[model samples]
Structure formats: structure tokens, C-alpha cells
Target: MFKGFLTLRPSCEVCGLDYSFADPADGPAFFVICFACIPSVALAVWLEVAFEAPYWVHAFTTLPFMLLTCIPPLRPLKGWLVASQYFYKAEEGKLVRLETPRNDDLHPHSA
Candidate 1:
């Protein structure tokens, strides 16, 4: 069984503005950011067929092209890629929260 998790911030904490849910049906912008790898994966498969390359070679070669394609479009997709990882875990335990403060909040003198 595959279970997916999405941590959605559906409102502005400061302004209390309501945002849409992150679910695919909600038509939120989250999926645009989160699914950048889908194109890359598809391209890899297409390249494999188009080039008639071995699976490993196609996989490696397409990676650089994918990176190139992804970089230009990253402004819209970056948030989604970052947030999508929260849905998967390496082990069978609940996700652990790290208490690290944001870089902006850390004082230069404290470091």
C-alpha cells in the first residue's frame, strides 16, 4: 500500500487569507511546483526510445538535459519539489521535526 502525505498551508498566518487545499482536485498551484520531476522522468523514457540507448546510458544522459530543462522553469517548480519530499519517509516511523531556526533569524555574532 502506498500512502501519500501533504502538509498544506492553506491560509496566510499573518493576513488570514484563505488559500486552496493542496489536493490535486483543488486546482492549487502546489502541484505545479511539486511535480517537476514528472517531466524529467517522461523525457528520460522518451530519450531512451528516441536514441535507442541502453537504459543506464539513457538514464545518465537524460539527467543533464533534464537539469537544463528544469533550471529555466524552476521559479515556478522549486517549491513543489521541496515540499513533495515530505510525503515519503525512509522508515516506518512518523516524521520527526527538526528545531533548527531559519537562517535569517540566526545572529552573525551567535554563530
Candidate 2:
């Protein structure tokens, strides 16, 4: 359900399914940050602590590694989440209030 690297198509080409409900906003990015960026950051920290690597080292190694690990999987992750939502028919929760009987309603006196 994607048209570009991170852009979604309006509808599915084969099934013609509307993608309006597929709002995986920040989910993919959050996963990437948690799974990929954290490790890359740890690598950077290790490099700094062990070898005292300079900024250029991070710019060359850590940055590219982080980008490669973080960027590539976002689209597929988003698609998987969207498909899961569709399969499960997930939607926003609605607040439903039930009426409770008052004490006066419980006791009705015949006049």
C-alpha cells in the first residue's frame, strides 16, 4: 500500500481497498528508534568509550549504520501494522455509559 519510500498510496491497486484507516503514525519510527537507533547509539558510545573515536568517525560509521538500519525497515513495518489492524478490524474505543437507577426510581409509592 505504498507509492514511495515512505508515502502511502490512496488505495490498493489489486484489491482496491481504501487505506484511509491505515494511520500508523509514528509507529514505524518508534519501532525503528527503539530497535535500530538504540543499538547504533550503543555502538557509538562503545566506540567513544573504548577508542575515543572522533566526530568524523561517528559521521562516517555510526551515522550510515544508523540510517541503514533505521530507514530500510520502516515501510515494511508500517505495512505489517496496517495489515494487522485491517485483519483485526481495529478502531478507536467508544465510551458507552449505562444508566443506573436512582433511589427514588427504585421505590415508587402509590398515592
Model 1 pairs whose backbones collide: 33-80, 34-80
Question: Which residue pairs show collisions in model 2?
Answer: none
- lDDT values for all models: 0.53, 0.91
lDDT of 1 by residue, 2-104 (tens): 0123344566577754434223333234444355557777777777778877868865777786666655554434334433433442233487898999886
Clashes of 2: 0
List candidate 2 segments past 4 Å from native. 104-111
Candidate number of the best TM-score: 2
Question: Could you give the C-alpha RMSD of every candidate to the true structure, in order shown?
Answer: 15.8, 2.8
RMSD of 1: 15.8
- The segments of candidate 1 whose C-alpha lies over 4 angstroms from its true place after superposition are 1-6, 20-46, 63-111
Residue range with the least summed lDDT across 10 consecutive positions in model 1: 21-30
Residue-pair clashes per prediction, in order, are: 2, 0
Give the per-residue lDDT of model 2 (tens digit) for 1-111. Answer: 899788889999999999887888889999999999999999999999999999999999999999999999899999998998899888877999999998778887832
